[model samples]
Target: MLKEKGLFGNIGVQVVIAMCVGTLVGAMMGQSASMFAPLGSIFIHLIKMLVIPLVAVAIISGAAGLGSSQSAGKVGLSTLGFFGLTSAVAVALALFMGVVFQPGVGVDMTGVEGMFSNVYADKGEMPTFWATVLGMIPTNVFQSLNEANILQILVFCLFFGIAVSKLEKERRDPLINGVNAIVDAMVWMINVVMKVAPLGVFGLMADAVGTFGFSALMVVFKLFVVYVVAILIYGFIFYPAMIKAFSKTSPLKFLSAMKKPQAVALSTASSMATLPVTMEVCEEELGVKNSTASFVLPLGATINMSGNAIYYGLVAIFFAQMFNVELGMGAYIAIIVTSTLGAVGQAGVPGPSFLVVAVLLAAGIPIEGLPLLFALDRIFDMIRTALNITGDAACAVIVDNMINDGPQETPEPESSHHA
Candidate 1:
């Protein structure tokens, strides 16, 4: 008999089954499925509750930690450069695929008209470049957090972290420890929240499938296919090639060892949750030194989001097509820039489906379309989280190579050393 993977061991399988069952019930029950919407809402609210504290603490701690070390500056610069380059590539690739596939070309918007009417009613024109730039700097940090203005929070945190990093060790240690404590608490809260994810996902899927039926999914089916294809290319082709080029480690072996963490990321749909496993795989299985893996992987989990960049680009273009919004070259350029920035700024924020609002605002796309995207966000989240962790591991390998002059030899087994 095949061994059962148990509840947590088979979470990905459970979620997939939940999605299918939700779709079936929704399709049969029609409008009645809307009742389950509250379950999803509560889940989203729980996620949102953790977002501000978690993001602020993670970013602040990560930035301050980097500033504390000497050679870390070099590592930080290298990591950022790698992240920027990879994110740019991911977004550009997404845009290319979106244009080629034209997934939103024939989507029927009649069903969602009522849902978005209020949003479109108050839709203002896109802000100018300078205005957008000025807006990122918060006039009142408290007000920014209250309003959940992520860009402003990001800006404030960057400066605050730098200031903290410059403080004397005696002063800095207390603050760092305090922030670390807060992060730990927030993560614990997230774990508590995630126990309800299957129910939440079921409700979300039920409502979406009931309201629009399979027809809505059909409209965006091409977009989904294109995204999956793009991610697979990144995961299987791009990552392996990058690893081979930068390090002497066998890409196949690296991927084999990464299976556990990747599974965790896929199931949990949270990079922060998968960080410990990623660190273990990088150090023990992939032969990276503790110093390099420790610094690079955690930072990558927070800011290096190749997957979100791609999703943002594709979603921006998809919505632009859906709404028949004509985007100029300037608008497309803005999409690339803002999407990249938003991915970094919005890291660790739950319910990222809505975080695309920042990109839409920048690209002049209607925020009204967000509700439509939110319906299918859970499905996309699983795939992107997997890609995100894959990118993190690839980065650790590359950074290790740069710092240590190619892959270090795997350490001798403990038992053999003792013998």
Candidate 2:
């Protein structure tokens, strides 16, 4: 019977059926359905465990490869330029979406202030953006590997790769080749692990549905609308226009190629896990150099979180309003700057955003309002991850174009025979 239906096809069919069954069971039994909840929670935890390592290894390896390429300088400049341009566009689209959709316009969050009391607080010691930059250099880079100090790891890898690039050809090629093989192996392992994704999704959904009950969907709806609008604006209007304005490639064509990776990102709700696919799409379909695309997209996964930044801005505003904490012009400016900088250093974990939100709340607003955000986080995360991957691809394409268009020095031919 299993062989009669294709494995993936059967799994997909099962998920649809399970969702329908879960919906019916939920509507009938309400929160009394306890069986699937624990199983689902475990599944979510397992997936979350993979995120930090996946990001650290992928970025370190990708950066090392990028640094080795002949066009390293051109690639680096283009990547930075692309990140700057796309990030600016993302912020603009987020602001526009907030105004146009007004997601928080009607939600009565009078009780939300009380919720913030349960949120975590930093004891007068949160690092400044510059301090955080310096902290990336771990006291012991190897010991801190699991903790995922990505910036430090990246810094170390960059210098190491550059040094390798300058080595004698015989020595350098073997080392680079070995590392490349390891990266390829890791990527292959991740793809294998992803085969169990439907089970994970089912587990997570079952748990959320069982515990939260149907009424929690109202919060989900609000976040869903905001997230969908934000993603559409960022992926469609913002990135496409930039591609057309900056690159030789057609924006529509580029977007079409990105669809598979975007879908994977949304499903996995992780930018890091989706990095390999993002790199592949950019290099193959978007015409980004493999070395450049590999490096920039991985780093972008770690640092260029435009979606999370938008979420930071919106959530800070939302919770403040919910708590009836009036912030003047000065406070809003502080939120924007701190949130944007903080997001770059954010870890790719399920609830990492909450920590940032908690910091903002601790600054003066109410942290208790975070429970409301938590209730809607999964829905929002799906969209946020998708938006993040889109920015990664856009950065790669623009960077590729810039490098190709830059000045070129023709190389002289070698003589057929030595004198």
Candidate 3:
């Protein structure tokens, strides 16, 4: 294992500096800043190349370790329950903020109107319950791997991991060791890939700022401000409070340790790409067990999207207010349910989200102004992603506390080594 020894060597510091520098360059260069896209692209590609394999092996090792424990069933159920509870709470918070702030009230859409169309009216209708369930079932797992279908891969890995846990001790030990060895290899690969993370962050920020421009912010700046407020509430205050109340973890300590992974999430704007960094930090700094962190973190990245839930809830309010559509009791319920479901349905990848469209339709809001938001989606996505990974880590810490018997996070003061 290798560690960044000092402040300048610290990846987090380097990335933060790169982000600031990139933003200035992008603002100056405008769209021409896109030349930096390749630096970001290669960085993202390196991270993505490891995601599928890392996820599969991590889940296998994690689930297998848990399956050997008596609390396996409890941990799984508790994890799901925690995610659902937090997501519902996130939507409620967003709705409250949207109403109080009134960000979309009396906004002019003079020029952006032409950008809207019913073309996307047929937009991605979320899958049916059975469809989503069946989709998780990989008919051909190898094909799923080739296609990089994360949900399907997760399902197969959990099942295979459990089965491995049932194996005779001699046989199981070697397989688990092999799977864990693969995870270590991934850590090494991530360490190597992260050498360029500062450059990647710079390129990504420059390209996004240059291409999207900040002009769009004027129209939705209110919504954007409210959005950030809601995200910070969830990410910083709510998550840390959860850790303090439910686990032995010090809120301040956990928050401080999480900076590196959150930085990665902010820059990449994709939880999947940030998964490796999140896992390392959880295991190394947060003291979450490999067994617990591996299973919970990967699963959290895949399905627990409290951050996206906030985005959906707020977006619904933005449109409903701008169009003067009054939301009824049922409409509020629909927003809450639809937003939570839609958020979970989404893969933890980066792009302009269409899930908000479904949320709007569910609450009978206008969809015309969606494209306007799309222009600034990357900025919104980056902030929310940082929040999303925080929730994932929070869940891992709390759930690990609930079922594990004793302290798992031994303080390691002598070693500055990292994953």
Top candidate by TM-score: 3
Candidate 3 Cα RMSD after full superposition onto the native fold (Å):
3.5
lDDT by residue (321-400, candidate 1, tens digit) is 98899989898898888777766655543454544776777788877766666666666786788888888889888877
The alpha-carbon RMSD values of the candidates against the true structure, listed in the order shown, are 6.3, 5.7, 3.5
How does residue 109 of candidate 1 score in lDDT?
73
Q: What lDDT tens digits, residue by residue, belong to model 2 across residues 309-345?
A: 7777666655554446676767666665656666676
- TM-scores of all predicted structures: 0.71, 0.83, 0.94
The lDDT per prediction is 0.72, 0.63, 0.86
Best by lDDT: 3
Regions of candidate 3 where Cα sits further than 4 Å from its true position: 405-419
- For candidate 3, the TM-score is 0.94
Once fitted onto the true fold, the runs of candidate 1 whose alpha carbons sit more than 4 angstroms away are 1-10, 98-133, 247-305, 311-382, 385-389, 400-419
Worst 10 residues of 2 by lDDT: 410-419
Give the distance in Å from residue 167's predicted Cα in candidate 1 to where it truly belongs. Answer: 4.0
**Comparing 2 and 3 by lDDT, which wins?**
3
